[model samples]
Target: MIHPAQSLRTFIGSKNFEESTRFYQTLGFEVKKINPGFSLVKVSGNLCFYLQDYYQKDWCENCMLFLEVEQLDAYWEAVKILGLPEKFKGVKLSEIKKDDWGREFFLHDPAGNLWHFGEFFD
Candidate 1:
């Protein structure tokens, strides 16, 4: 059976919608749709995700996203230089380290949505 959908996009909660959009943009995701209460962001070619203005402590705190990249070190350095954690306000970014998968790191958005960035080992 052929799948009809081309991709899956995750909807992430963002309390501070404006700043949250900026945060994703600063991290290299192209802001496609930005309105009063929602945003559609694209990372690279096919990866995309949504930002909802609605905020729920339970849902936001438990949300997670995993992104794979080719240049892990560069991405880590860029995020550090931009000081995303400080700029995003209450965001946290972990150092990139090697794991069973590959070099990766963790970070959270202002709304508490966790994100894991990694370069898988082939």
Candidate 2:
């Protein structure tokens, strides 16, 4: 029998390890530096990913992570108040957009990784 997986984490590459770590921290993620070249970022205990000191233009630009939230509007407002676009070069944020399935807002990290924060209608 196949056992259920305990947890899952993804590897996100960064163009600059230090700056990328700071970016995530600024975005309110808990970051623990593993070394000079890597760090583990956690949105929560079970929600985490690895940040590696690695990048490829094609891969980094194409990489996208979807984060599901309970309140899209509130999250968007908080994100706006953070002023990430003004603080970090190359960071970009978009207005919340509605889709047939759900609504989401876009955020682009300095390394060009795209993040989709959304919530589905009940």
| TM-scores, one per candidate | 0.90, 0.96
| Residue 56 C-alpha lDDT in model 2 | 94
**All candidates: CA RMSD (Å):** 1.5, 0.9
Instruction: Please report the TM-score between candidate 2 and the true structure.
Output: 0.96
Q: Please, what are the lDDT tens digits per residue for candidate 2 over residues 2-95?
A: 8998779999899888888888998999998898788889998689999999989899999999999988999999989999999888899999
Please count the clashing residue pairs in each candidate, in the order shown: 0, 0
> Model 2 segments beyond 4 Å from truth?
none
What are the lDDT figures for the candidates, one per model? 0.87, 0.92
Off by over 4 Å in 1: none
For model 2, what is the alpha-carbon lDDT of residue 116?
99
The collision pairs in model 2 are: none
Alpha carbon lDDT of residue 57, candidate 1?
89
